[model samples]
Target: MASSQEFVQYAADQSSGAGRITYRKMFGEYGMYCDGKIFALVCDDQFFIKITNAGKRLAPGLTETPPYEGAKPYFLIEDLDDRDFLTEFITATCSELPMPKPRNKRKSNDTVPKRRHQNDF
Candidate 1:
């Protein structure tokens, strides 16, 4: 089942301490990003944070579960009421995740051949 927008927004608002929290449609679910790095996801109304060493250290009793089918387990965050803890935990986790890869740049002329000047050769 698809997650509700209200739930996604609540997740973003709760993690605002991480800085510039945003959510996007990702593979029929929602991807929570901060500073261009995806740190968590909202699937089926459940919030799941990426399993990072920092996260594991912060919450040792985290319930590990996959956000979707055929995916690795993430730290299932059940307590969203505590905004401070969520922000702190998510900030630490985001620090461990790598930034998004730069997109490939292609020159426009590469696709269409350049026209030769009519000057005498």
Candidate 2:
């Protein structure tokens, strides 16, 4: 099942204290970002935070699972009500993660060349 919009909003709101939290639709689920760095995912109505040494230190027994099949295992966070804990943990995780690289801008003149088919040739 796909994650509910309410669940993604709650997750983002809970972690807002840590930084500028945002969520984007990805693969029919949601990817949560903190200050431009993706740090978590909301899939199947569950929240899965990216695993980091800092996060492991915070929750020693954190459940780990991939939000999607064949993806890297993430820390499966079940405590969504604990606002303080959620914010702090997110802060720690983001601290350990590198900032996102800036995206390259496409030149206005950039365009894809059409391929000539055998019939057209």
User: Best candidate per lDDT, number?
Assistant: 2
**Candidate number achieving the greatest TM-score relative to the actual structure:** 2
Q: What is the lDDT of residue 95 in candidate 2?
A: 92
The 10-residue segment of model 1 with minimum total lDDT is: 112-121
How much lDDT does each candidate structure score?
A: 0.91, 0.92
lDDT by residue for model 2 (1-121), tens: 9988989998888889999999999989999999999999999989999999999999999899998899999999998999999988999999999988889998665476778999996
Over the full model, what C-alpha lDDT does candidate 1 score relative to the true structure?
Answer: 0.91
Total backbone collisions for each predicted model: 0, 0
Clashes of 2: 0
RMSD of 1: 3.7
Model 2 residue 1 CA deviation (Å) reads 1.5
Q: In model 2, state the lDDT of residue 47.
A: 95
Candidate 2 has its poorest 10 consecutive residues by lDDT at 106-115
